[model samples]
Structure formats: C-alpha cells, structure tokens
Target: MSDKKLLLLSSSREGQTDYLEHALPLIDGFLDKSIKNVLFIPYAGFAMGYDKYEDKVNQPFQTIGKKVTSIHRFDDPVKAVEEADAIAIGGGNTFHLLKELYDNELIDAIRKRVDQGMPYMGWSAGSNVAGLTICTTNDMPIVEPRSFNALALVNFQINPHYTDYQPPNHNGETRAERIFEYVRANPHRYVVGTREGTALQLKDNKLTLVGNKPGLVFRDGEKTRPIQCNTDISWLL
Candidate 1:
C-alpha cells in the first residue's frame, strides 16, 4: 500500500466564498497538528505577484494554525523541500506553474519528498500537477513547460474546476466533449473531472472524494462514471 498523503482540491473557493475560506476546515483536517511549517509553492500566480500569492494563501493557513513559507523566498528551493514538514501548492495558471516548477528544478525534489510520506496539499493548478501529466489541465497554454510531465504522484489525470454549465449563445465545445477528445486520443488513460467545492484525498492507498458534489471519471471504452463522496477510488491508484 502507498504511504503518501495528499489533499488535491478543485479550487480555492466554493461559490462566492472568500479565498480559501471553504477549504480552511478541510486543510486543517488534512494536515493536523503534525504539520507545523507548510512549504508553499506560489508559482501558479501569473497575473498576481508571488509575494501577494503567498500572503493570500498564508491567511487561511494561519487561521488553521499552520505556518506557511513560500519556496520563492528561499535561496535554494530544493533544500527547502528537503527540510519541509509538509507542502501546500496554491492555485493559478497551470501552464505558468509547470513552467516555473521545471525552471526551478523542483519536480524531482517534490516527488522525492512526497514519496517519503510528507503530506502534500494543492488546489486548482496546484492539484493538476499531482497527476500523471498536465495534459488534462483546463488552463490555456500561456507558457509552455519543458514537457507536460508532472509529479506523477497519481496514475490518472484530473480536470479541476470542472463545470457542466455553458454560457448562453456560445458555440464552443462543452467540458465533457473536451475530455472525451482527450480520452479518444489516449485510450489507456483515466481523467477525473473534479468539480468546484470538491477534492480528492489520498491516504494509505485509499482515495476519497471530499465534498457534497460528485465527480465524473472518464476512461477509454467505458461510460463516464460518477464518483460519490467518501467513495474509495483506490482502483485508480
């Protein structure tokens, strides 16, 4: 059984809630008192500056009684990962975050630390990197990474901020259609369309959907299945 612990959130906010407000209780429960200093990665902030992003994330974490130290503040990020008790990656542009992760050479460092059983938490683009690759990301390719490869912490892909709503009078591919295209192209892969307010938590080789809403799982040659809350999805692990 895998020893890794992860909390992958679809978004920082649910509905009109304040930033990270909805996720505060979840984050508190995920890390617990064992995690004191959380290594924060804010590279996902493209439009917003990294310092601001760090502060934005720090607020909720402090409320939950956890201290946050962003990787950007450190002179050697790899070393920071080595000493971190836990890690939390904040949300933003997926393409930009992946590019920064590659540029900073954190991909392997993070993978190694998390593999060693350090708790890892992420939201939005943050959660996307926990998957096999960034190919299933919902963000536009504003910046290209060295590759679409990610932490590979999980075997499947995750489509964060998944929604079924389409604006009126718009002639665009629906979210499901786009994911179907990905499945058609990669027949061997699985993609989980995780909606807002929902998260996927992995602990002791068990994967549970956290939230009131159900998430959709897509696979090749099979109808998309709805994953209900508290369901064990270790089959995908």
Candidate 2:
C-alpha cells in the first residue's frame, strides 16, 4: 500500500470541457517529472480502434510535455507494462476492458508494477477497474471477463461518474438506490461515489478527494456521507 500512487478520475470531461482538458492539471501534478512516457491501456475504447484511442490521448499528453504509447502497439503487452515509467488507462466499456486485460494476461503484470511505485492514473471505466471489483460500475455488461475482480489497486469499490440527479417523470432507479443495492449484498465493503469533475489521489499514504464537487461514501447499515474535496480519506486504505 505504501508503494502505490494513483489518480482515479470520475470522468474525462466536465460538462462542455474539452477531452482531458479538465484533468490535465491533476494529471500533470500527479505524474513525476522524471516520467517522460506513459504506457496507455485503451482496451475499454470499443468504438474506436486502439490506434485512434492512442492518438486521442496523445493530443492532451503532448500539452504536458509527455508522450503516450498504447499497449496495443507493443508486441508484448506484459513486457510493456513491466518497463513503463507510468501508465494511464482511458475510459470506455468496463467489461470489455477487463476481458482484454485478462485475455492479454496484463492484470497481474500491471498490479505488480503499480505495487512497485509506478504511477497509475485512469478515468471513468478506467477508474472503475481500479477498485476491488467492477461490480459497482455503471456500464452494462456487454462482455464478460475472466472474473469481476479487478486490479484491486484500491481496497474498496468505486462508483465513478456518480450523480444523484433524478429527472422529472424519470422513474428509473436513482444512482443512490443502485449503490444501496450493491452495499446491501456486499456489506463490509466501502463504495466511493466520485461525482463528475472529481478525482481521488493517493500518495504518501494519504488519499485526497480532488475537485470542487463533494463525493459520496456508502456502506451497509450506515447513512451515505458526503466527502468534501481535498479531504483525507486514507482511512479507507
């Protein structure tokens, strides 16, 4: 746990902000200056090809004076992870991403690398996979992975892109109700509902919620609580 460095974002864009524009500052600050290149995992990007995904991410990374290389470009993806200075996983479909990771056998490789103090950052579905399991993700199960278990980068579950808003005449289950159902079945676990534009940063044995909006914390038999921005949530660790 002491060796882990993570930046888990709720979403890639905030309302009308440009792609990766809202997160550039946090991304730049979270990554060490010594990291010249970031290994990118674009498995979640099902609509666009990996090459296009790489190009999309590079657009903003170049602004920060860093380069991004997608793992799909490498002959040996596992070796790529082992040798990367840092890694970033982009958002798309969670199930597809997890399946590809399992199929390529990069799960253990990535977990091992991050455990060795390599910086890891992700957004949306990418952030969903950073938790103990992908059960809390909002994406529908379009594909199945080897298992729902994920990287376990963080001990608890994460509900990224969280929103409590229920539109008029919309009778669908609210996000809170959905999360309540999850905690009811998995009582001991904690789920952090990271709102749009928010991120969770873990460094120096402390976890800080980043953003202007407040996040939510959920557990069985307990009232949901709001986690203020810049608050230390290392207790979840």
Per-residue lDDT of model 2, residues 1-237, tens digit only: 367999999999999999999999999999988898999999999789999999999999999999999999999999999999999999999999999999999989999999999999999999999999999999989998999999999999999999979999999999999999999999999999998899999988789999899999999999999999997899998
TM-score for each predicted model, relative to the true structure: 0.98, 0.98
Q: Give each model's whole-structure lDDT.
A: 0.91, 0.95
TM-score of 1: 0.98
| Candidate 1: segments with Cα more than 4 A from true spot | none
Model 2 CA lDDT for position 14:
94
